[model samples]
Target: MTAPVFVVEGAVPGDGAYVLDGPEGRHAVSVKRLRAGEAVVLTDGLGAWCDGVVTGSEGKDRLLLDVGPARVEDEEQPRITVVQALPKGDRGELAVETMTETGVDAIVPWAASRCITQWRGERGLKALGKWRATAREAGKQSRRVRFPVVADAASTKEVAKLLAAADFAAVLHEDRDAPSGALASAELPTSGEIVLVVGPEGGVSPEELAVFEEAGALPFRLGRSVLRTSTAGTAAVALLLGRTGRWG
Candidate 1:
């Protein structure tokens, strides 16, 4: 198996040594029980990483590491961004986690008109924090050098703007007459941002659908059966990855 991955605040890849401390260090030592001389990888979550071995423990929550040469990885082409409408309770975090692990480059929380969950003030901030934390943890577990970004909640208008800026954008809807086609059939660019918008549990409103399509976001369907709001984005991303040759 590959060495377990960890995230550091900042990284100088070529440096001969580095420290793993604080909460992550504690987890490595106490939870993972990483002993001295075990191999590990540390990343800055921006494509820079260093492979290293634990030299010794400085304290309960700290480890000194002897790092080898550092290297920077190139970001993948046709970067994928998922605009996921907020789901009820912890379902939002579930979507974020799965999407992150599935190779989404970024995630945007959407507050659709029909959304049952409304985020405001402290609640919204806390929820956003949870999404970020989920993405970070998922990235570590997936051994990703570049972690997905969890963007702030987006209103319908903001989501439209994002769709307009994307090279290719698709809005997932289940309508039979919505000019819907299989997501797998869509033509993706070789490089650039590709955005996928998923509506809430109540689904996308007609007015919202019009706005998205008007912004050049084509309405697409995943398959014959409809999926829950929490998993739709993840499935759509998988299709995109395959279509763009990222999965191969």
Candidate 2:
């Protein structure tokens, strides 16, 4: 099996001995029970990583490692970003977690018109922190060398601007009457940015849809059945990963 992964604070500093300490060290020594000779990986959560074998431990807080060279994985092509309308309760974090594991490069938390939960002041900031934390944890769990970024929450007008800047933009919608198509049939971008929008439980408001349309984000569906706001982004990402050769 691959070595268990832990996060460090900065880029790897070349082939040498490195100390795995502080909170990460505590997790390694006490929680993971990492001992001398056990293989482990460390990352900065921004593409830089190193693989090493544990060499020793100091108390219950630090672990030493005899690591080889540090290397970085290139950021994936057709950088995928999800514009997720905030879900009610903890589902927002769930959405962030799964999408990170599925290889989403970045996430934009959207405050859509129909969203029941609003991000305002301290509570909003706390919730955003949770989403970012979930992404980091999930990225490590998936053995991803590069973690997804959770951007600050976006307003409807801001979301439209993001859509306008993407090489390809899609919004997950179920309206059979409106002009929409399956995600499988859309011409996915190969090199530039690709943005997909996932609406809230109450769905995207019609007026907001018009704004996104004007910004060039096409409405697309996954299949006949509907998916929750939390899960739709993951499924869409999986499909894009497969089609765009990112999974290769």
Candidate 3:
């Protein structure tokens, strides 16, 4: 069986002995019921990871492990980034979790014009925190040493800027009159960043589409079916991954 993965604050470089503690350690010891000699994986969630065997537990939330064979994974090519428009309710977290598992390099919470939900003041900060946490947990579950970066919530103007900077960009919209063809038709770049823009449930406004288009974001439909805001980003990312041979 594959060793269970855990997120650690940091891992020792090279082969060495290290102590794991804090909330994650507690979860490993108490919640996961991990005992001494169990094999596990620890990651800093920034491409640094090590395999370890638990030596013992040191009280609550503490586990000692002898770690070795550190590895630093380089970022994947044609790095996929999803500009996900805010979804209502916990669906926002749903988006973050699945996208992370699908191997997206980054996720941007777009505050599109038609979003039913609004994030303001303390609520916005808290929501952003939830997205980050979801990404972190999903990354561990997927055994990823490199977690996706959850960018701050962005306005349409900000998203435009992102599209402009991207090597390739696409807006997932099911517009029958859209001049662009299906997303599969677009040439997937093998290097640099590719950004996929997913709009809200109510859909992207005309003004927003124009802005994205002006910034070089082409509009393309996923398929004949319409998907909810929560599921759209993940599906789009998966499609991109398949096209780029990342799924292979």
Candidate 4:
């Protein structure tokens, strides 16, 4: 079996000994049953990683393997961001996980006009934490150097504000009259942020679409068939990544 990968807090070199802590530490010791001589990979979630061997397990978990030299790669092209409307139950978690694996640069939880599940009180923060954790694990598994950011839930108005700050923004609507073409085929700006907005289960209300349209977000269709909130964002990310030449 391949050695399990873990994310650390700081930048990693291709060679060196580093420490693991928190959940990663627990996994290395308790869950993975790693002993003091096994090899594992560690990443800083910013395109830096090291191959090292487990050196110690006392106190805070520590790895003493000789790290290879550091390698730094440019960030993914197109820098796709998915502004997904929060789905009920585990759907949001599933969406975030899949998007991470598919190479989304960031994620924003959107609360739209037709959204039935509103994240409020402590539940909102809790859910956000869970998604973040899921994203981190997915990134490690996919060998991605960066961990996708999960923004706090935003209302329709807040989403508009976010779009104003972005270079390219589009809202995925089923009612769009035009055929939803592949995002890769779309003429995107050479550089700057790209944000894709996805609606909730009930879908984006007419008013919400108008709000996004007024904010300069072009409406795009994903295809003839409607996709669940969970699948749309992941599918969009995969297309964007492939178009940007990140996917082989």
Candidate 5:
């Protein structure tokens, strides 16, 4: 099996050495039991990764890694951002985790009319932080050099503003009259960003749908059956990644 990967900040070729700190450091030393001189890969989560050799442990909290030449992957295709409606309980967390593994470029928590979860004060930040951590872990497991971003929670109106600023946007709806089938039908921008809006358990209200429609977000259907919030975003990401030729 391949050695477990870990993320680090500001890793570069010729930097010679770096420290793996925080929870990631603990995982490398305590969890993986990597010894000095073992080869591992470190990424800055921006398409750059370096094969490094562990020098030694610095106490129980840090691991010293000697950096080497940087290797960069081809730039990802048009960024795909998923604006996921807040699901009840831990379903939203599952969506974030799965989307990360599927190579989504960013995640946005949406508070729609039917959303059962509300982000209040620090709770919102905490939730976003948790999602970001989840994304980071998933990216490492998938051996992705770039980590997907998790955005702060936003209401439907605020999400509309964010979508309007994107180069391409689509809203997933079960409406039979939707103009497109899956994301493949829509003409994706070849060199710009794409944002996908997913609804909650109870589904998007007509008002919220109208806002997205007016914002130029074409409504699309995944299939005939309605999928759970957790499943929908992940399925959508898979399709988008495949269509964009990122499913390598």
Candidate 6:
């Protein structure tokens, strides 16, 4: 099995005896049952990573590791950002988790005009926190050294500005007459940002689509069937990763 990955705050020693404690340590020692001599990994969740051997485990809540030299992975090219409109219920978190695992570079939560779920006041703050937490956990599970960033909620105008600045941009719309062919075959830049906008359950309002298009974002379709707002970003990202040769 692949060595499990755990997040670390602050600096991780290049190579030495490092204490793996606190909630992470408990998860490794007690929950994961990591025993002495087992292999593990530690990451700062920003590309810096180190392999470790579990040298000793304490009682039921912690462990120590013989950590190796830390190394940083260079950020991959064709950075993908998904502008995901708010979905009702916990599906926002679901979208975040899957998209993080699928290797999205960043996620922008948008409050589209037609969104049924609105993020307001404390509820908005809590929802954003949940999305970030879900991304962190999913990144660990997927063994990603660099976790995706969940930015502050954006408005339609802000989203349009983002698309206008991107090297390549696409809005995942399903209109037969509107969508431009398969996103997989679309020309993509090897470097720079590729932003994909996913609308709400009611889909992108005509006004929203016009704003995006005027910003130079073309409409693209993932497949024949219409997908839910929560799943569209993940599916689009998977295609992009494969097309960009990152999945190779």
Give per-residue CA lDDT, model 3, range 98-166, as digits (tens). Answer: 999988999999888899888899999999999999999999899898999999999898999999999
Which candidate ranks first by lDDT, i.e. highest? 6
Ordered by lDDT, highest first, the candidates read 6, 2, 3, 1, 5, 4
The alpha-carbon deviation from the true structure for residue 145 of candidate 4, after best TM-score superposition, in angstroms, is 2.1
lDDT of each: 0.88, 0.90, 0.89, 0.80, 0.82, 0.92
Candidate 4 wrong stretches, greater than 4 Å = 1-3, 10-15, 19-22, 35-38, 55-63, 180-184
Q: Where does candidate 3 stray beyond 4 Å?
A: 11-13, 176-181
Q: Residue 17: error of model 2 in Å?
A: 1.5
**What TM-score goes with each of the models?**
0.96, 0.97, 0.96, 0.87, 0.88, 0.97
lDDT of 3 at 131: 96
Please, what are the lDDT tens digits per residue for candidate 6 over residues 124-201? 999999999999999999999999999999999999999999999999987636544478788999889999999988
Estimate the lDDT of model 2.
0.90
Query: Is 5 or 6 the stronger prediction by lDDT?
Result: 6
The candidate 1 region of ten consecutive residues with least summed lDDT is 175-184
Clashing pairs in 4: 14-68, 14-69, 14-70, 15-67, 15-68, 15-69, 16-67, 47-145, 53-65
Model 1 off-target regions past 4 Å?
Answer: 176-181
As for lDDT, the candidate ahead, 3 or 6, is: 6
* Model 5 C-alpha lDDT per residue in residues 1-248, reported as the tens digit of each score: 66567777664554588888898888888888889989888888877888888999977768888888888876687888999988888787789888888888899888888888887889877877788888888889888888888878878888888789889888888763764455767667765788999998887788998999898787888887789989898998898777777775
Q: Quick one: RMSD of model 6?
A: 1.2
Give model 5's TM-score versus the native structure.
0.88
Pairing residues by index, what is the TM-score of model 3? 0.96
Clashing pairs in 2: none
